[model samples]
Target: MTDSPNSATAAVTLVSGPAGTGSIDDFELFYARRALGRFRARLGRQGLLDLLAADIDEGNAFLRESARASDGGYTGGTTVLSTQGLGAGEFVAWMDKAFADENVLLAAQPEHYLMVGQANGSVHVVENVGPHICSFYLGDWAAEAMAWADDADELLPKADFPYKKATNLFLADGTIVGRVLIQFGETDDGFTSSLTVYLPASCPQDVLDHHLRHFAVEFRNWITAAAAARA
Candidate 1:
């Protein structure tokens, strides 16, 4: 079960890198394919539940331990990413357990996106080619981004910052470990600029590396298309 109210968190992808995409469509494609691949690989082992509840643990690193559940001899684990003051090795070690839990990793298979490592407290392997599976949870994957975006939208609106075309939350892919949001605004010279933000290390290093590099290019391309559309 879920911990205290404050500890509640859902798995999501927030990809915020430097503003590079020259348009919007390009950014969408970048995140859709490359970033999605990266995120899938990152969760090669850990189930979605562990990633969503990552905020509950006090440790900055994610942990995976095979413990017995109250019901059947189900597997149980814990993690604490985005906590604070955790070493790199410790973080990676905890994340790697996802693999030990299963012999599979996302880096080895790029096409396998939108996976569910565990269902009904049991382990199962899946790939992106089948179905989005996201419909199974219905807005669950976007929880992190939605939570933060709601607050940001309110605060920004109050400040009258002219909230521009803000759309499409980023999933954990490549170097991005959390949800990413895309926002754009017009400058005094009538130039549109955008910014990307990363949630944290929600997944593995190798996986993040692959998604981020590709996403950055995608973001840039997206920005370009967005600007063109506005013109």
Candidate 2:
């Protein structure tokens, strides 16, 4: 922790007092630790969408459109979501069919995570992890990794996504050892359309491995399933 004459103390600060951080997004994930979390498959598409909709600010429009309708604020805010995990390509195809968008961008990434865009104002942000699609709690994995990455860095960069890094590692069970970032971006068959998934290099090893495995399996299944149905 260093201090300077020209900044907000040159140290990390918490925003949980008087104003409750005003906006949940205000909380800076100065460091996030990664841990071994679990994932389970949900019953159906709607089931998964419901879970993703939780905790999201509603004014974004995509959530509103997907979950039926809403008042336009709590149900419409910027709803950037992280999937438990998914195959980069398969998830996009699902979005293409589900939203019936002729121009959807689905990106397959190295860490078994996928990023899809529901930018049309009335679309879905869905990812199909294997049967373990429920939830993979990165434990404080991403958090701790973020901190380690922070101290080692001569710089402090923002995720440019809904996620962030924070401190507070030391999980009760066992301490997570390591983590990293994987980036994936893709465009539709048309070339001018796209979606980008920027996962910071702040995550642990096993957790990262799981996503890689998850992506490989689920993505293949997604493609196979789609082909089977078509045939």
Candidate 3:
């Protein structure tokens, strides 16, 4: 098992799992086996999520700022990293509910945004951003995000920065509660990279924490399952 030198509080690890060698040179090994075991033993489900969210949030802020300065200036494409501690479905559902019936969050710019439904997916448009400020909805955002995280080629160049990577963290219920977008530049020394985590202000801390724990446990199981499938 190799421990990823992150922060003092969050000790992420990569361990050799059943799935062949269980090493994605691209990603730091999933939380270390020993570290995860200890963490699990130490906290409840909610506690785990809280810790993960905090760590991810911190990582997001640092990465976004770093990306802005990576080339001595903002890259200007998609410079932000939006990550959350919820699954795609959950997040979508939440958005629908939040925007449903015009309940909370005073809508000051409903006219600025438009939603267009298509047979295959949906299209979201922001009027102020220009005619091209639109995105097509696709299947399983969580799955797509995970694929993007795992492979640079699978990344969405149209929606993301030119030299960036997006990754998703999944829970046991298959809910992706965390994602990171990292921008990198090739240089003589190697690659300069910056990361960002997406967090929604509407989400309550407790709700976020609950989901974080769910992901923590599920992630451990996922690693094992992935290894077994590959093996």
For model 1, what is the error of residue 200's alpha carbon versus the real structure, in angstroms, after optimal superposition? Answer: 6.2
Candidate 2 local Cα displacement, residue 210, angstroms: 1.7
lDDT of 2 by residue, 1-231 (tens): 422223463455454565544443233221111110112122233443465544222312222232233221111011112332334344445534633422221322212222332343322223322112211212232434554445433222333222232322111132221232322233233111111111223322332344445445434444444444445
Sort by lDDT, best first: what order? 3, 1, 2
Q: What do the candidate models score in CA lDDT, each in turn?
A: 0.33, 0.30, 0.35
- Residue-wise C-alpha lDDT for candidate 3, range 1-231, written one tens digit per residue: 322223256555676655555545433434444454455447643464464555434533433333344432221122322332323233334344443222121122321222333353322222211111211121333334455454443244432334543444332233333344544343333223233433233333443343333333333332233333335
Native-referenced Cα lDDT, model 2: 0.30
lDDT of 1 by residue, 1-231 (tens): 631224656755546765764455556655676776656557643554465333323221221111111111211111111212333233233333443333234333443323344343322323321111111111222323455556453223413223322223212221111333433333343322233333233333433344344344433433333344335
Off by over 4 Å in 2: 1-95, 98-198
What TM-scores do the predictions have? 0.28, 0.25, 0.22
* Candidates ranked by TM-score: 1, 2, 3
Candidate 2 C-alpha RMSD relative to the actual structure: 21.5
Indicate whether candidate 1 or candidate 3 has the larger TM-score: 1
- What are the runs in model 1 whose C-alpha is more than 4 Å off? 1-145, 150-161, 164-178, 192-194, 197-202, 227-231
Model 2 earns a TM-score of 0.25
